[model samples]
Target chain A: MEVSGGAPKSKVKVGIPRALHFYRYFPFWKKLLEELGAEIVLSTPTSKKIVEEGVQMGFGELCIPMKVFYGHVLHLIENHPDLDYLFVPRYVAEDKDAYFCPKFLSLPDVIRILPNVPKMLNFEVNVKEFPISQSVIELGKQLGVGQSRALESYKTAKEYFKEYQDFLRKGVPVNHALRLVQRDLPFTVPKKKSKGDIKFLLLGHGYNVCDTYINLDFQKKLRDQGIEVITIENLPESLFKVPVIVNKRLRNYWRHEEEIMQAIRYYLTKGRDEIDGVIFLISFACGPDSLISELIMRDMKVVGIPFLDIIMDEHSGEAGLLTRIESFTEMIRRKKRKLEMDAKKKVKSKIKSEV
Target chain B: MVQVSDKTDGSKAEKEAFLGIDVGSVSCKFVLIDIDGNLLTHVFLRNRGSPIDSVKDGMAKLKEAVQENEELQSYTIKACGTTGSARYLTKAIVGGDLAKTEIIAHAVATQSMYPNVRTILEIGGQDSKIIILRDGIIIDFAMNSVCAAGTGSFLDHQASRLGIAIEEFGDYAVKSNNPLSIAGRCTVFAESDMIHKQNAGHSREDIIAGLCDSLVRNYLNNITKGKDLDEPVVFQGGVSYNQGIVEAFERHLGCKVEVPKYNVLMGALGMAILVRDHYIDNETETLFRGLDVSEQEFKTSTFNCGDCPNNCEIVQVKMPSDENKVIARWGSRCGKWEVF
Candidate 1:
């Protein structure tokens, strides 16, 4: 939807990188920028050149997020420099006492170190602590909209943002998260659904799970297994359960660790009666995920259930992944038979002993 | 009933026993702690080349000890808990009530012994970790898995190279009044510095002491970086038993660190305690198959799934019985393994 009654759209285009936090927060940005009378340009998927350029522009030690963000910005500047500036939101906790990881807080600073990037624009949104409305208003004013006009645009854009959220949460199997943000309801996009012979759960960092281009063959391989794949977004949020032991370790973070634990717990406990097996999808170098995956393994052992830990990297080896999945599915099939046989044996033994 | 076992003082009614196994890469420790946390029998064996054989041998010794003492034979096998890297393998060998991560087991065991401990510095055979606790809750911590500069395995490697048994390493370090300089940032650098110091004619004792100092320094720099290490520190893990390292820690931090009595078998102890806690609240039969489980044969293989970009590599362990059963499955990041 195009914004109307704007004092002519700003000639300069704004660049948005379709990476990291882009999948979730981009719509708010796209709608807000458009309403503020600014044009928007989002960078494409991360590739060899993008990653290489990102590494060059940022501190050598900068984490993957910063590296990927730099690459996206570099792509925009080299390809579409007509954009007035690059928008990189520095989301800080609204309450001074509340804090984020040093990495998230320092992201904008890392971007500043890059060479020949667009004029970077940023605004802090402490979602729970700060009134998001005020932050959006101030950002609108900074983009040259009058106070009243900014407020009106912010209200209109806020409606669009809610509509966008309701759209994506529907989990229509379309690969593009951006399109989901455009409509008010779950769009009947052609989904890559397979009436699978095997059903598997996909667990991982939100960025890796939601971004299709990062993990190229995610849907196709599942379709091959006729495996019905389930992700965190598909499940009811209320069904997530956090193990009591994990609560202490997750106290500082914004329920991210809790959400992961909850997602796994929900699937394992509730889906056990429905699904065939589970597969944990994790990033190669993610720290918190490595630990969480270990915890899940132990949980599986205790419950006498079977599971798998599938780690993904930028250079994900398809051959390696295929072999692991094949074996795991085989193992699951074998275990199901064994469990059924054991149940039958118990009944036979009880009847014979009674006689 | 045969005479009650020494591990169990007829002080508690309804005789029940727990098998605790801590299988590390370098060493495998097995202990039978009674319901009251009293040590009944314990075995510490080098992991050598095979974890399966070590567990079998340990279980055999436990059987012999129980049988030899007529009174102890009355106490039945109740439940078991396994910890460490090879705990999964050990669990497969000895079917039991629960399996837990080494971290949770260690933390639980330490908390039982040092309830007031604010920080736990656990440097095990292959890895090192720092666990912080406040209000009896784990607050924040870090584990060093990638590097071996501050781990017990590195110390063992250096001791063997210097032609000294690992047992003598602590004594030699303690004897040195002036430790020679040794780089402990990495194994290669530390070995080179030790060789240089030896060629320069430094005493073995001094060099060993220097190595201990370097290990302590590396631990402080890497594992304890930016951590709020508070007082009432409890140092446990296999490395905690090394007096030389303990002394070096004292000198470095200028604080007295308390080492729990069962430092080497703390993970197993923690698992046992968790089992006891979980069982006391419920009435259920222990799934433990007794000593005969050690005689079973098991095989492991790996395969990959091409279903998604996250190609999960799954590890499967097979057990042979009248029925060939696929006993355990793991190694998918998604719930793929669980669904299977």
Candidate 2:
């Protein structure tokens, strides 16, 4: 809430629509903008009306998340006409080999053409072309901030972002970690205590999994059933550093896909004994997910791990999803019981032979 | 089967039986089974958009059947389970001991009948599903509830349009030697294609057979896509009664498709079995309100809560005996008004 840069008491308002990468990188942007003395304006959370408006504005065949993003942007534009600028970042690639999905890379361009939109403070965040620090500096320059002031604010935002990532690595949920970051509270690593129940690894895009309305409160449903769910964002950064091994003849260059694959590999290689099953959540008609899910399914089959793939869209009903999750958890629990019984029987036989 | 004694003494011993009810959008089904999982009696009725009335009528018929049979009279209902689209509403109405989705109920019943069943093709009135099993465990499944081209209701509509009874429609399909090819992607397109074939002077038998083949094709293309379907497949639900569709599945898969005697009542039977298992494992008393629930008066109403932007329409059901007391409330996103 503190406006650091001293130009005017009422700083320039920057609208940040809550969609897509908002869940992942909002803290960094918010901190940097505030440090550069800009007031942040966020759109309302996703709802039925927002989605309906988005559907009317968007053409058919776009993914639900993308449509929802458009709706959020429209909401911000319509509600906050007094906003000075909207921050729409173009994220082309995160790593050298892995590029973002086409939707993410072209999001700024897609929103630029929408009618009745306010001025946009667009900057490139591609590592190869324009690094994040450079993008932040350019964003500051657009707001008439000095280069030294922008550099200092960017360094402070980077430190906060790193702290937020550390919280995520410790298995805290993204939303909860964001609150802690906003409150400027120290991150306390959540202890991993085994409750002697089935543990499932839920893998999906940050937007799809974190958005309650989009995923139909999937995490709460699982937790209510006493099933422990660990999401891909909960995995340590070191896990993502491991190389993803697809087929020698094929390559998957999507950054999100690579992150999910690395998490799956980590669970399969080291956390197999701790985890009971894996649930791969994907949006309907997602091209990247279609291929990544097939590869993951094949790999899971080879590793002999229990897996469930749930595809969601606007038409996804909650009853069907609950049924599938119930059956899956029951199956895992039964398998775990059988394994324990077998172990007990083996010990009983050894004691009888010794006697 | 156990025989009833001739003695009419009131002190005669009573056996335990579990009741299962399936309140679907199109039909309501009821099943009664003994503690040993033996089927006692079952009833299937059309829903007609009133689940409460259908459940009451089904329960009344079930009570009459139990009273008419001497052997069934010896058994007392110990527990009740509900499944289907209206499972939650039916569970609250009947005070069910167990409630589960149709998928789990159908899978459990099929597994009980054929212990080694690896795949199950169930086509109900409004939806169709393919359940994949391995080692008596369900691992994967898919349901095509969005489309009507592959479900039983579409076939019924087509049968009515052709002025043929749904029961006899299958017989005509079986008599056809060479079935005509019809598009099966969408229901509207398929209907137009069927009419066009009729105008082209194709025999009714071949067209019906072609319609059956089209439905089977749609089912396989949509529900079973990317699935590894193994042998010992069991096809059930209301659609399984149609021999033409059964033949189409067998011919398409190049394997035998087994249809149990009580195929349409599998969901109810599965719930009965599950309730029996739950009772035995937990050693708990039954939650069944009794046969008198058929005569009870209940009311349901909905109100949209404006507490948040979600504007969730919360449903509240008033108990029959006490109109002032709301028995159940749901449909809230934040679980603020949920009471059951």
Best candidate, lDDT: 2
The RMSD (Cα, Å) of candidate 2 is 3.4
Residues B1-340 of candidate 1: C-alpha lDDT, one tens digit per residue: 2222233455543577677788876788777777897777777777765777788777776677776776566665567778777766678667767766666677778988888888889898888878766656554455663576868888888889899888878999999989977888898899999999999999999998998899999999977765567878889887887788899888888889899889888888887886776667665666665776557676767888666644667877777673657777766655467343
Query: For model 1, how does the per-residue alpha-carbon lDDT over A18-53 read when each residue is reduced to its tens digit?
Result: 677676577778778888888778786666567677
Among all windows of ten consecutive residues in candidate 1 chain A, which has the lowest summed lDDT?
A: A180-189
lDDT of 2: 0.84
TM value for model 1: 0.57
lDDT of each: 0.70, 0.84
Lowest lDDT 10-residue stretch of candidate 1 chain B: B1-10
Number of backbone clashes in candidate 1? 46
Candidate 2 chain A worst ten-residue window by lDDT: A189-198
lDDT of 2 by residue, A1-355 (tens): 3468866567799998888899889888888989988889988878887888887787899999899988999999989999999988888987778799998888888899999888999677788776777887888889888889999999998898887887787778787776676566778865755553668899999888888888888988888878888888778788888778686767779989988999999767787777888988898879999898888887787777888888888878877787778777876776676678889999999999999
Candidate 2: stretches off by over 4 Å: A1-8, A189-196, A341-355, B1-13
Best by TM-score: 2
